[model samples]
Target: MSADEGARHPEDITVPDAVSAPDAEGRPRRVTRRFPLFTRDTARPEGSGRAAPLDAPAPARQWPILAVLSLVGIGLLLTALDVFRYGTLLIGVALLGGAVLRWLLPGVGMLAVRSRFTDIATYGVLGLAIALLAMMAQPDPWLEIPFLKDTLHFTVSG
Candidate 1:
């Protein structure tokens, strides 16, 4: 036989785990285990094998905010029914509650609510001022005019 004839035998080479190996029955058996995306780092074997945990701690519980929000919702319902004379006060309380939450727990507070309450309070105060001014300027709608005393009829025709 020549010196280079089949010198490298197939049995001498080491095949990776992904390649199927024959079982005792001479049938190829599948390799179930998956290989890592990257080869292991030679410098640190333990660090390369495991990854750092990424899960964060649970957020702290906030109960006062829930209670205040519930109270504000109930006040809003009463104001909507027209049974409450202090509707603005109820609305202000709700807005103030949101503001307090935002101030106390900024991470948990809704950003939209905080921004909206700022504008709501500003415009609400202005609107209340204008309404008061109008009320002071005009006479009551129930009062009668002197010039058209005889011509005006009290009864409805329809």
Candidate 2:
């Protein structure tokens, strides 16, 4: 048969029908499919796989402040029990001096001095008034002002 006659034959060109499946090495070209937001089966996760179960317990949180507060309470109790003058002086100097030092820095000094003076003057006047009242009153007075006396107590005699 002539080359022209063979080319014209139906068996010459092999066109695959839809019924034929892809071979092992040949994967069929994927068609772009759109999924609606409401669709269930087509929906996939954003980044990773399945999320944690609803019933799973969450991680516990802690408060470091609470621990510090408890330690402070213990320290205060110990200080109270000791009755040491040095301990009292140390706490007073450390806390009060640190506060004063913070205020004493260049820009802060003026406001700090003003606050200190106001407090000193107000407390001083109050202290003096209480002292005068306590002195004039009887040995046992119903009202006791702490600023007037170092040791304020009521003594009863039968």
Candidate 3:
């Protein structure tokens, strides 16, 4: 609203004293300020920083994610080339590696997708599940569970 309009309507939300007060940053502090629907400023997730110095090349600065992505790409190629089990295992290992990087490194660039704990948990759980499933897949499974076999038989038989 215009200053004249606010002056006319004293009952409006124009807290003259509070709005004029300077904050630590010297910006006007609004006492009755509500959160904006969309924030203009956002804090980066923890560990989301360049792996290399600012002067380094883009690839070097973002090497952590690049490494993970490269592994995943190779895994996809292997899967396409008919090495199903190994390819899936490789992909899972890549995710697990990403989790390890996030945990150990102080900065991981784009590898830091979310909060450290959440990212680690997500990557670890998904990686382990994929690897375990790959190990148990198809004819002559590597890690067999008799109970699972029975349950599968029962469900299909029914």
**Top candidate (TM-score):** 3
lDDT of 1 by residue, 20-52 (tens): 878999777886576544544534211121111
Residue 149, model 2, lDDT: 56
Return whichever of 2 and 3 wins on TM-score: 3
User: What does candidate 2's lDDT look like per residue over 1-158, in tens digits?
Assistant: 88876554443444444234556877644423543324335432122121223353321111222232344455456568873333333333333333343333322211222454453454345434543443445546546567545444333321
Residue 75 alpha-carbon offset, candidate 1, angstroms: 1.8
RMSD of each: 23.0, 29.7, 6.2
Identify the candidate with maximal lDDT: 3
The 10-residue segment with the lowest total lDDT in model 1: 44-53
lDDT of 3 by residue, 56-158 (tens): 9999999999999999899899999999889989999999999999999999999998899999999999989988888898967778878988999999998
TM values, all candidates: 0.29, 0.21, 0.77
Using lDDT as the measure, what is the rank order of every candidate, best first?
3, 1, 2
Of 2 and 3, the candidate ranking higher by lDDT: 3
Off by over 4 Å in 2: 1-83, 106-158
Question: What's the true lDDT of residue 62 in model 3?
Answer: 99
Taken over the whole model, the C-alpha lDDT of each candidate is: 0.46, 0.39, 0.87
Q: After superposition, how far is residue 80 of candidate 3 from its true place, in Å?
A: 0.5
